[model samples]
Target: MYKFASTASIAAPSAQLTLSGSGVFIFQIGSALGTSLNSQIVLVNGALPQCVFWLIGSSAVLGSGCKFQGILMASASIGFMDGASLVGAAYAQNAAVTLINSVITVPPACNL
Candidate 1:
C-alpha cells in the first residue's frame, strides 16, 4: 500500500516567467505573480499518469491570464498558468525535468 507523507517539496517550480502581454499583458505580465503549493498529495508508481496529485489551493491570479479561457487543448505539461495545467503524470524512467529560476526571493535574513 502507498503511504502519505511530506514527500519532499518537489522543490521544482512547474513554471516561472516574466509577464509581458496585454490586459494580463500589461500589469500582470509586467510584474504580477502567483504560486502553487500542494501539501500531502497523492503519488503513485508505474505507468503514465503515475502520480495523481490534486490542486489543493492556489494563490489568487492578479493577471488576465487564461484561468477560465480553457487551456490549449493537449495532454502534456501546459505552461499557460491555467488551473488545469498538467505538471506530470510522469514516468519513473523518463529523464528528470530541471526547473531553475534565478529570481528566487529569499527572506532578508536568509541572505546571510
Candidate 2:
C-alpha cells in the first residue's frame, strides 16, 4: 500500500498502488521519454477526489470503487474494473480500452 498526494508524481517499479483515504493522486506510470515498457495498477478505497495517470509507453489497470477527476493517457491500454468511476477521460493510443461494469462520465477523445 502506498500513499501519495495530489500534487506529487509517482514513478515506481511496483505494479499496484493503493489509496486509503480521501484525496487526490497523480501517477506517472511509465517513462515520459517513452523509454520503458511496464504495466501499472491502482486501487482506490474512499473518495479519490482527483487521480491522474500518465502512461508514455505502458498500460494502466484501475481497481474498483474509485472516483477520478483527471485524465488517463496510455500508449497501450486502460482498463477499469467493476464499480469504478472516472469523471475525466482516457486516451489509449495504439491500443484499446476495457471497461467492465465501470462508469466513465466523460468519454475519451483520442487524437487518432
Candidate 3:
C-alpha cells in the first residue's frame, strides 16, 4: 500500500490515513529486502491500532530513540535499536524479534 526508499524523520499530516498521535504515515520499501528505519518519530494517526508496516519476505528495523505507533508485521525479522519504542505491537512471523533498550507496548484493546 505504501512505499518508500528511505526516510530521515516523519512528522507530517495525511488526508487519507489518520493516525492517533498527530497524522497518518505509511513508509514502505520495495519488495526486495527489508529496510532499516533510522527515524526518531514514526507516528500513525488512527483511533485504533492498525497494521502500519507489513513486510513480506523482508525484515524491519527501528533505529535508536525511535518512537513509533501502530503494528509492525514482518515475515523475516524485526529489530529495535537502542531506546526505540513502539506503542502498538510487532510480529516477526517466520523469524525473530531483537530489542536492545527498545520497548514495545501493546495498545489498548480496540472495541470496534
Per-residue lDDT tens digits of candidate 2, residues 5-34?
222232342233345555544555443211
Which lDDT values do the candidates have, in the order given? Answer: 0.21, 0.52, 0.58
Query: Clash pairs of candidate 1?
Result: 19-29, 21-25, 22-25
Could you tell which candidate, 1 or 2, scores higher by TM-score? 2
What are the candidates' C-alpha RMSDs? 18.5, 9.6, 6.0
Q: What tens digits encode model 1's per-residue C-alpha lDDT throughout 17-52?
A: 222222211111112123343211221232112122
* Candidate 1 TM-score versus the reference: 0.17
What is the full ranking by lDDT, best candidate first? 3, 2, 1
Q: Considering summed lDDT, which 10 consecutive residues are worst modelled in model 3? A: 8-17
Give candidate 2's whole-model lDDT. 0.52
| Predicted structure with the largest TM-score when compared to the true one | 3
Clashes of 1: 3
Return the number of clashes found in candidate 2: 0
**lDDT for predicted candidate 1 compared with the true structure:** 0.21
TM-score of each: 0.17, 0.50, 0.61
Off by over 4 Å in 2: 1-27, 31-53, 107-112
Candidate 3 wrong stretches, greater than 4 Å:
1-38, 41-56
Residue pairs with backbone atoms closer than 3 Å in model 3 (clashes):
4-28, 18-45, 19-44, 19-45, 19-46, 20-45, 20-46
Name the candidate, 1 or 3, with the larger lDDT value.
3
Model 3 clash tally?
7
